[model samples]
Target: MKKILFLFVLGVFFFVPSLSVQAAEEFLYICGPCSRNFVPIAEDVIQELALEDNVHIKLVSCLGACTASPVVEFKGEIYGHMTKEKLFALLRSYFTL
Candidate 1:
């Protein structure tokens, strides 16, 4: 009984911190229908950066900006009219890469 309790405590110590770390990572959201054509390019940039672990990418339906067709938001900042160069620059600035 004592051994089981010790093992449980050990497991919790390792598991809980990892969950928090994952939650703390940066979140990037791309407007799907609004962003239209730019979504795949942004995804490819994320892949190229190997930022799969460091950043969480979410595909949202719309950012409420129909005019800003290719919109992306990161850390509460809205970026619109994204080109591959612009996306790369943003990722570089965010990651300091």
Candidate 2:
């Protein structure tokens, strides 16, 4: 019984922190149906910046900002009127490129 308890504690120590680290990873949400549809741009910039390990890009249907079509959400902040150049700038600033 003591051996089993020790193994369990060791497993928790080794695995729990990894789970929290994964949970803390950043997510970039792009509105797909928006007029600009910057998903491709976002993907390209993420790849170009080599931020695949640090950022996750997700294509969402709508961010409810039609007037601000082509919206992007990063770090819980929403940015509107996004273009290729703007996205590049944002990611560059984010990753300090």
Candidate 3:
């Protein structure tokens, strides 16, 4: 019984790291107001890049970029004044299929 439990723990330790990498691939966030104004653009860019699965899109309440109401957070960087073209260009690095 003890040996079985030890093997389970060891197996999980080896398997968890790969999951983290998949979790790390996520890369899109739109603030509350941004969502209403920019979701379509965001969706189009995702479809254009075929990143429906490769990247994650999150709708947040506020990213502290209200000065630039339509704000987007991507890969840990905050970008305001978001436009479809700019978003498309920014996402090229991550989704190049």
State the lDDT of candidate 1 residue by residue for 1-97, as single tens digits.
9999999999999998887734237878888787757767877888898887777778887787778768888889888877889988888887888
* Candidate 1 lDDT: 0.81
**Residue 34 displacement in candidate 2 (angstroms):** 1.6
Q: Tell me the whole-model lDDT of each prediction, alpha carbons only.
A: 0.81, 0.79, 0.81
Residue 56 displacement (Å), model 3: 2.0
RMSD list, candidates in order: 4.7, 5.0, 5.9
Q: Per-residue CA lDDT of candidate 2, range 1-97, in tens?
A: 9999999999999999887834235888887787445767787887887887877888887787878878988877888888778878877787667
The reply for model 2, stretches above 4 Å from the true place, is 1-24
> What lDDT would candidate 2 get against the real structure?
0.79
Of 2 and 3, which scores higher on lDDT? Answer: 3
Location of the lowest summed lDDT over 10 successive residues in candidate 1: 18-27
- For model 3, how does the per-residue alpha-carbon lDDT over 1-97 read when each residue is reduced to its tens digit? 9999999999999988867845236768899764557988898988888788766778888898888867999988998988898888888865544
Clashing pairs in 2: none
Error of 1 at 22 (Å): 9.2
TM-score of each: 0.68, 0.65, 0.68
- Ranking of candidates on TM-score, top first: 3, 1, 2
